[model samples]
Target: MSAGTSQETPATARGGLFVTFEGIDGSGKSTQCRMLADTLRARGLDVVLTREPGGSDGAEEIRRLVLEGDPDRWSAETELLLFTAARRDHLERRILPALAAGQVVVCDRFADSTRMYQGLSRGDLRASVDQLHRLMIGHEPDLTILIDMDPAKGLARAKGRQGSEERFEDFGLDLQQRMRAGFLALAQEFANRFRVIDGDRPMDVVAQDVLDVVAAALPERDGDAGA
Candidate 1:
């Protein structure tokens, strides 16, 4: 389906919840996503916790190219294409299948990240990003949890992380601040499917907040064999 098209059937029609988390780096989206997946699984809901840029084997390879190289390894447009490719692979190989099997797919990040990161860095390519998305990948999650936090705090946390995947984080704080604004704006643009969570609080507290939002929105399983 094209990104511009909307499916009429509820997300649950496919037998799963497509939940994606978005935020500026260090907003703790990955942690919260994992927590929600584990919590739901414990409740007897089949859950598939995954991440973007590297969910499936193909995407993971693309992820390494995009995230582990020099900061300027790819131009803004090229980087966008790479991210789009990864997302397509993730959807085809992991997300769609898991959802079709009636499992909750909690993705660490999704298209919104692409929109924000690219728009913030490239500035003039936002429209191209949208156009590309509509043409190549037009699916959105049933629910998107956006963890909001200060840019300074988020940048610090992200820098402290262990990994060579610091390409985006290497943009420094200015870009992250802009990305933060971009994400908040997106939350407003796609309000129906987005729940903005304050990520500045204690980890457990933020986790519960995530749980609360998800609990209120998760669809009933109804004994779906696929689940």
Candidate 2:
């Protein structure tokens, strides 16, 4: 086992498990994160449901700036900084506290989205954003679920609910395709910490699969491998 894997042995680790969900728009990550949290809570574990870019109060303000602001007002680097700022507040105020209390933290989106969206979308900002991620989050998630889906399908679903596209969502097909590739590559690079799910499946089926993966990833439930 590698050093990182050795250190992650559940028998020796006392911190709460931090799991993150990642994918394109309308990939059903938000729903699945809630489902997984509910499942873990049912098992008598304390669970916290949170999201990136807006978990904490300060982060929410930044989220508005990034998501609702005029497109001409912010450059890619500026957008990246806003996200990093939100992430810093989220980690300091929410995530770390919940983990310290031994509650499982299931985030809808986290650092990986930054890499896939900002890094892959902008290209020039990848290194800086990654450096900020390492400096802010310190530790990677225990497990990251990448809900892989076709861009066209995902965007159609997002449009149905959102009605209109936000700046990021309005990036069109080319950017979404690149974002999907970026996520897959990141998953491959971090195999032990990543799992890819077929997002085209029905919501309940996808949720069940995510639950199974989460169950298998937990150290204490190793015996219940088929959950």
Candidate 3:
């Protein structure tokens, strides 16, 4: 993490910078999250790289329950509650503490994900998602990086992964298309905190754009990570 002081945001009261990545399935947000963390760590900054739905031990358990079952296994409402619960645990156990300790927190997905997946895709529960978020997880990331991709391409990449967490991908390409649109709408809804980047490019190209957006959001770093 860059030892250079990060800007304070109303969304994050703690000292650390809170960055989140969001996109349709297989948009490479997870890979980018890891790359960003690695880059920051190499610079000597204190960083905490984590993911939603499975960041904390408890959340990980819920992740399997929601992600491994059949697509019709749970109603949209039930899934929303489960995801919110997992997010709450993740926030309290991992995010809050890391921020309080003044470490940069880079999360692969956050509430905006719930806003897209549960709120828009599965059903018209965007209002409920916001209500639960305000009631349970009142915080938001300081910066949100939205990776925009062609839904079909993203779905193909997602299915190609052959991972156990295939519940969402099983929803098929139509759902992926809707989700891509929903995410773009969300980026507009929270324009100030969001930075949308085209994800159809090479990994290095996408990563460079992500880094540039992040750098614009943060203060210039002059000190070493250990400083």
| Best lDDT among the predictions, by candidate number | 3
Tell how far residue 102 is off in model 2, in angstroms: 0.9
lDDT of 3 by residue, 1-227 (tens): 11012232343467777899999999999999998888778877788999988899999999999999699999999999999999999989999999887778899999888988888899999888887877788788889999999999999999999999999999999999999998888887778788999999999999888877766655345234322
**lDDT string, candidate 1, 104-143, tens digits:** 8899998888888775555567778777777777677889
lDDT of 2 by residue, 1-227 (tens): 32233332231154677889999887878888888888777777778999988999999888877776354567877778888889889988998888777777899898788887777775667777767766655557888999999988877777678642266777667777888888998898778888999989888899889988887766573324334
Question: Which residue window of length 10 is worst by lDDT in model 3?
Answer: 1-10
All models: lDDT? Answer: 0.83, 0.78, 0.85
The parts of candidate 3 lying over 4 Å away from their true place are: 1-12, 219-227
- Cα distance off (Å), candidate 3, residue 118: 1.1
Q: Write down the RMSD of all candidates, one decimal each.
A: 3.3, 3.5, 5.4
Query: Between candidates 1 and 2, which one is better according to lDDT?
Result: 1
| Candidate 2 residue spans exceeding 4 A from truth | 1-14, 163-165, 221-227
- Best-to-worst ranking by TM-score: 3, 1, 2
Candidate 3, number of clashes: 3
Error (Å) of candidate 2 at residue 168 is: 1.0
Q: Sorted on lDDT, highest at the top, how do the candidates line up? A: 3, 1, 2
Alpha-carbon deviation at 35 in model 1, angstroms: 1.0
- TM-scores for every candidate against the unseen true structure: 0.91, 0.88, 0.92
